[model samples]
Target: MKKKFKHIKESQLTITELMLPSHSNFSGKIHGGHILNLMDQIAFACASKHSENYCVTASVNKVDFLNPIEVGELVTLKASINYTGRTSMVVGLRVESENIRTGEKKHCNSSYFTMVAKDEAGKSAPIPGIILTTKDEIRRFARSITRQNEGRHRTSRFSSKIFKTDAYIHLLEESNSKIELK
Candidate 1:
């Protein structure tokens, strides 16, 4: 049986929460960990909504914090499926912060989470394909494919057996790290 295809809008989700003092770090800004937790939640929600099955975070690809979120601001997170595999989907997440009084908005972070759909037996399950309707949707899907390929290449190249430490020793010398090879 073939799985039904779903559209991006079908599983898109947005969450807005007021940043509290409790969610702040020592510097009095919203904690990055807290934002990551929220990102995971939204990714899971979006993936499950699209797959109609339990989903777990397989990997978090990229999490770049562009701005610091203030405790008094309103933080919003948007999530949607960028690409789908046999049992996995890449959930693209964007986090933004808005100052309540000034109405100023800042892009706080952007992340990509790979989620795998699970069956009742906790095994990998088949997931629906994405229906790309617009140019932006097509571009996102294409970018996901590129990211996946690059990840695979990196894993293979850096695998224990394949990696040659001596070949890249000079690269490390350029950094602050000291090679205390025993």
Candidate 2:
């Protein structure tokens, strides 16, 4: 069977919600966990739309909260297919918060979610490839590949079977931690 491909725009999704007091932390800012939940939802929606199969989040890349969200602000989350593998896709998400009264917008977070398409039997399923139409799309696809490679290397380096504590023990000496090897 021939492989199928889809343009990045075909599966793009965007959602906006108004922040409320119920979603804020004790510090009066919108909670990071709430934003993360929204991001995951968008990622799932984008991936499922592109693959036409149910998708589950396999991993989430680094997430940094760049700006605090006010309770009355409108938060918008945008998701797009950045890269696609045989059974997985990287959904790149960007979040921004806008003050309703002033129309000022601030970037709150940017993240990459790795999602795997699943068949009705709950097994991983192949997904359509992405059509990179712009330089930005190409760059994002390249970034996802690089990130995956780095993740594999990092995991192997710290795996229990091959990890050497001594090799990294001295590196943490300056930190506020004590090494008590039994």
lDDT of 2: 0.96
Question: What TM-score fits each model?
Answer: 0.96, 0.97
Residue-wise C-alpha lDDT for candidate 1, range 1-182, written one tens digit per residue:
86689889999999999999999999999999999999999999999999999999999987889999998999999999999989999999999999999999999999899999999999999999999999999899999999999999999988999899988888987898888878
Candidate 2 per-residue lDDT, tens place, 1-182, comes to 99999998899999999999999999999999999999999999999999999999999999999999999999999999999999999999999999998999999999999999999999999999998988988999999999999999999999999999889988998999887769
Model 1 score (lDDT):
0.94
The candidate scoring highest on lDDT is: 2
* Worst 10-residue lDDT window, candidate 1: 173-182
Residue 169, model 2: Cα distance from true site in angstroms? 1.7
Number of backbone collisions per candidate: 0, 0
Which portions of model 1 show Cα errors greater than 4 Å? none
Top candidate (TM-score):
2
